[model samples]
Target chain A: MFEGLYSALEQSEVITLYRHINPDCDALGSQWGLATWLKHRFPLKRVIVLGHQKMTNGLFPDSDEIDDETVRQSLAIVLDTANVRRIDDERWQSARQIIHLDHHPQIEHFADLEYVIDHYAATCEILAEFFSTVDQEPLEADVAEYLYRGLLTDTLSFKTSNTTEHTLAMASYLAQSGLNIPQINRDLFDVPLKEYEFASAIRAEAQILDEHLMISVIDQAFLDRWSMTASQAKDQVYQFGGIREIEIWAVFAKDHDDQRNTWWAGSLRSKTLPVNDIAMNYRGGGHKNAAGCKCLDDASLNALIADLRRRLKENQA
Target chain B: MFEGLYSALEQSEVITLYRHINPDCDALGSQWGLATWLKHRFPLKRVIVLGHQKMTNGLFPDSDEIDDETVRQSLAIVLDTANVRRIDDERWQSARQIIHLDHHPQIEHFADLEYVIDHYAATCEILAEFFSTVDQEPLEADVAEYLYRGLLTDTLSFKTSNTTEHTLAMASYLAQSGLNIPQINRDLFDVPLKEYEFASAIRAEAQILDEHLMISVIDQAFLDRWSMTASQAKDQVYQFGGIREIEIWAVFAKDHDDQRNTWWAGSLRSKTLPVNDIAMNYRGGGHKNAAGCKCLDDASLNALIADLRRRLKENQA
Candidate 1:
């Protein structure tokens, strides 16, 4: 399945890598790992990594600049991204050929070529398998470190449901290259004092509504108080995650919209319940266990809560 | 080194397993894992697991009950614990023979036969290595699940400084036995709503003293308000851990001693500083990065803070 992708990498004079916007460690890891691997294997090839938004962890390198002409003549590999809208660099569409590699379920057939393994824990896992199969050159420690970061972060260090025997095997194979697991972990997980403080405030504001549904509202005032943007505050909703009693959890942060109506955008997560469909109904969506959505007003928020409560009851039954 | 222990297991008709007091998942997993393996291997033999304080996670079964006479005739194997004071069961002393299987450094030699590997990620990893070596029988999935739990929790899902290539290898070995990684992860890590709420209170109460040290003080009143014990509230100190900019972090929870002295007992953590010696000076001790101490009064707390500040200055200098 990866043969075509491998061939393209070998044939192309220039390669560009693009990850999803607002990227997580997995996205950055895959992007950087592939770029490093390509640069090491084909020293003469020009491999560039590009992304718009900077990662919050500050672990990976900054994005590189490439002109439209360069991209038009390059092989573009979009990594850890599910759809076209998420591709950080729109120039990928203008590339000579596009290869989409992802671990998410096939949502849209937008890519020219796709390598989607929905059951795999991460894109790095798929790449690990590809590297082992290609037999051109063994994965080096430097490249392995970046790939391992993706595997570790995407599975939440192998705590996610998609984690399997193969996940550990791939991780062990990468570790054989002497990746610094502990240092990478600390670099990715360690938070700043301000982030920790903001997380605490989010937790304090969490409410267990309807005995099973958890909701946390961070209005504009709260965001201003913390000097944080809506996305910055809503990201802390993960602090409310992994709770046993809360069947479904959501964090709504009111956007500082200049329009006549105030809107609240947020993220939602669940351990066993289905929240993606609910999020989709509210003009946002994601995986079954995790999702996101936005509401125009307080009434819509209440309705979403009611719908979530109904879903929780149905799931329990 | 495991020759004598394997012989003892084969010879003994009654076997008792012991773990450390205030047991964590590693302690419980090693205890139950070895017991389950032995029970399956030697069906005629009696296997009992004994512990005092139950684990907060409540993922495993309750500790079994056995009288002193039974222990006296059994081969007792203690897991995870480093010293005699931490042994949960006193009857282990009366056992016909004692075997210590631990991953911690050799602090005090109390057992007759010791299998201690300080560099191993978890006691369960040691057991996994032992199982592969014994060759009499293979490790079953049921036993592997318990071992996997220990490996997962002890290393914080393989993020701890001690995690090694062998750690990933041992975990992969266990996963090969069909362990449910995701379910076990959720069972172990999922927090209760009340605990999450209390963690927020701890964070809200956090203080940045001396511009580098972070502290969260939970008085008796605060504990009462949360309906939590001093230890429970103090555990929230982890909420402040792995944060950048804070040289040292501490959680001081007021404890009402029976002797009419109001003491403050707490846990201390640091990202790049040594705090154990200072903690030892305050009537407690632990590793260089993590430690604990108890103070008898406000003056003692102030003195400890001053000492920490001085230590920080010295470290910086």
Candidate 2:
């Protein structure tokens, strides 16, 4: 399936890379891993990676400030992005040809050459598999390190459900290329001091309702108290997710829409129950176990809680 | 090193497995994994796994009720045990010959034949490597699942410092033999409702000291309220270790020794600082990052806290 892309890589003199907006380790890793491999294999070819936002520290190299003309001259390769609109660079459309490499469910047939493996944990896994099929010598230490980070972070260090024997095999294959596993783990996971303290505060404020539901609301008051944004406060939702007694959990935050209408945005999670149905019912959606939704005001938030409680009672019964 | 052990496995008609006391996933995994592999390969040979206590759910099988006569006829293998006193079954000494496989710093020489690799993350890694070298056919799915659990849990799903490329390679090899990585992870890590609630309660009561250290005390009254023992409370120390602002953290629980001596037993942890020195200054010892100790009274506990504060101040300076 990637034979065309392989041939394209061999034929192309210049390549440009694009990942999803607000790129994660998987997106950056796949983008960089592919670029490193291509550059090492074809030393004469030009490879440019472009993105708008950055995560954490600038551990990976910065995205190139390439012009539209440059993008028009190069073969644009987008990695780890599912939706067409989610691509960071609008200039990706100006490229001579487009190749999409992803591990997300295919929502759009945007690329001229597409390779999507939804079963694989990360785009890096797909890229690694493809790299393995081509020349093995080009998959150097640096390339392996980047790909491994993507795989590790995407799977939450192989704790996710999608992680399989193939995931471990791919990880092992990359490990064989010689990389510091411990350092990589640290660089990707070690949190800053303020973030850690903030997490402690979130944990302290978590409320266990009805002996089954764990809810933490980071409303305006919480934001004011912590001097953080709603999004920043909501990111600590994971702190409440792992609680044993809580069969269901939610993190609600106060936010406003573009029209300046007040709303309560919340992320819902469950261990076994289907919360996506509830999320969908509330004009939002996600997977079976994890989901999210938004309500117009406090009354709707109360109603949603009541609905969740009723669902919990029904679930227990 | 395992050449003699391979010969023993081939020649012996009976085999017995021993793990460390208060056995964790790594100990049980190695024991069951080796037993399962041996039983599958050498059908005629009888194999038994022995342990005094079990972890959370009796997910691992129980120790057999065998007499000293049966033990005397078997080749004993102790897995993931550092010291002879820590071995669950005292009957191991009665075996025809003994083999010790561990990944802890050697504290005692008890087994007739010992293979200890401190650099490896888990004993399962050593056993898996040995199994790989001996006969590939014996490394069945059941064996792989058990070994993978040990590898995963001991390394905290490859978050530990000792988790090397060999550890991951061993895990990958086991994974390739056909095992559910997600299920294994859940079985080993996913806490029950009660445990999760207890963890939340602990987190709620956590205190930040000296602006850098996070401390949680599960005193006698708190234990009585929660209906938990000191050991059960101490286990939650890992929950605090990963938080960012905390350079050092400690969990202190009030308890009494066998002699009715009132004391506060506690575990100490540091993310980057040298905490073992402070632990050693008191009546405790551990690695550079993690250690344990006991204090006679409240004064000693306060003294320990002051020492830790001073250490933290010194560390920062």
The prediction achieving the highest lDDT against the true structure is 1
lDDT (tens digit, per residue) of candidate 2 on B61-151:
8777788899999999988998888999899999999988899999989888889999989999999999989974637888888889888
Candidate 1 per-residue lDDT over residues A187-273, each given as its tens digit: 778787788888877877878877888888998889889999888887887777788787788889988556736788979888777
Prediction 2 global C-alpha lDDT = 0.84
Which stretches of model 1 miss by more than 4 angstroms? A1-13, A67-73, A90-98, A107-114, A132-141, A177-180, A256-260, A315-317, B1-7, B67-72, B93-97, B108-113, B133-139
Model 2 per-residue lDDT tens digits across residues A1-317? 67898999989988999999989999999999999998888999999989988866666988778778888999999888888899998889889999988999999988899898999999999988888888646368999999999999988899777787678778877877767776688788777767766777776677888998988877777777777766777677776665556788888888776796778888888877888888887878999988888764788888888888999999778
Q: What is the TM-score of chain A in candidate 1?
A: 0.88
The total of clashing pairs for model 2 equals 3
For all candidates in order, the CA lDDT equals 0.85, 0.84
Q: TM-score per candidate, in order?
A: 0.90, 0.91
- Per-residue accuracy of model 1 over B195-271 as CA lDDT, tens digit each: 87788778888889877898988898899898999899878888877777777889999987679578899898887
Worst 10 residues of 2 chain B by lDDT: B178-187
What is the CA-based DockQ of model 1?
A: 0.62
Q: Docking category for candidate 1?
A: medium
Best by TM-score: 2
